[model samples]
Target: PDECPLAACVNILAPCRSVYRWQGKVENTTEIPLLIKTTRACYAALAARLLQLHPYEVPEIIAVPLVAGLPAYLTWVATEVLSSP
Candidate 1:
């Protein structure tokens, strides 16, 4: 929550089970994904901060561009992020 203001908002999703291979072995774990809404301008700072906070040595951090969205909502995201430090 402390890092929320870095972006417009964050959507915490339900915990999901993940299965992946690491160090030549398969592993399973429960993880709660977060959907963060922010502009491309803010992505670098947000990702850098997440890297500092995440526990994993290589946490999954990827950006998917918004091809379409409600105009007002998109504006709000820009406004909120721009207004932040």
Candidate 2:
């Protein structure tokens, strides 16, 4: 267990190959993705912190609304994110 004030949890996924166009050129790179679990209330802060810490000029940061989740799990996440740091 760890103290994460801005997010309930974060999963550092395995690195994967990425291909995209940037600065008018196609690029291929290996990137590590992060799966973050946080409440809407904490999203802004989390994103800001990531931007401050991330080395990349343009990092991929997006939120996908959960369509459905186990009720108990969802409540736990919300509680964790809202609890005092």
Candidate 3:
């Protein structure tokens, strides 16, 4: 078994900044991001689980569909989460 705590944990160079009204005033901030890769079978469970753990009032949970990918890598992603430790 792998030493990873999750099936797949990826770190990408994502630099972001968002502007929002907090207390009747606009505020902006920059932050790093964590990109999680999970399968369709596990998406619902993962989203629900994250909602419970996340502290954001309206957390951002976005899924970007893959237009194309290597067959073997895609297969690995589909089954990785279900792998037994």
Give the alpha carbon lDDT tens digit for every residue of 1-85 in model 3: 1543243556655788878787799879875566887766666777776678678776777877778889999888866776432
The TM-score values for the models, in the order shown, are 0.90, 0.86, 0.70
User: What tens-digit string does per-residue lDDT give for candidate 2 at 1-85?
Assistant: 2645778788999999999999999999999999999888888878888898899988999999999999999998888785433
Pairs that clash in candidate 1: none
lDDT (C-alpha, whole model) for all candidates: 0.87, 0.85, 0.69
What residue runs in model 3 are displaced by over 4 Å at the alpha carbon? Answer: 1-7, 12-15, 83-85
Q: What is the clash tally of candidate 1?
A: 0
In Å, residue 35's CA in model 1 sits off its true spot by: 0.4
Task: Compose the digit string of candidate 1's lDDT tens values, residues 20-76.
Answer: 999999999999999999898888888988999899999999999999999999999
TM-score for candidate 3: 0.70
Give the local distance difference test score of model 2.
0.85
* Ranking, TM-score, top scorer first: 1, 2, 3
Best by TM-score: 1
Q: So what's the TM-score on candidate 2?
A: 0.86
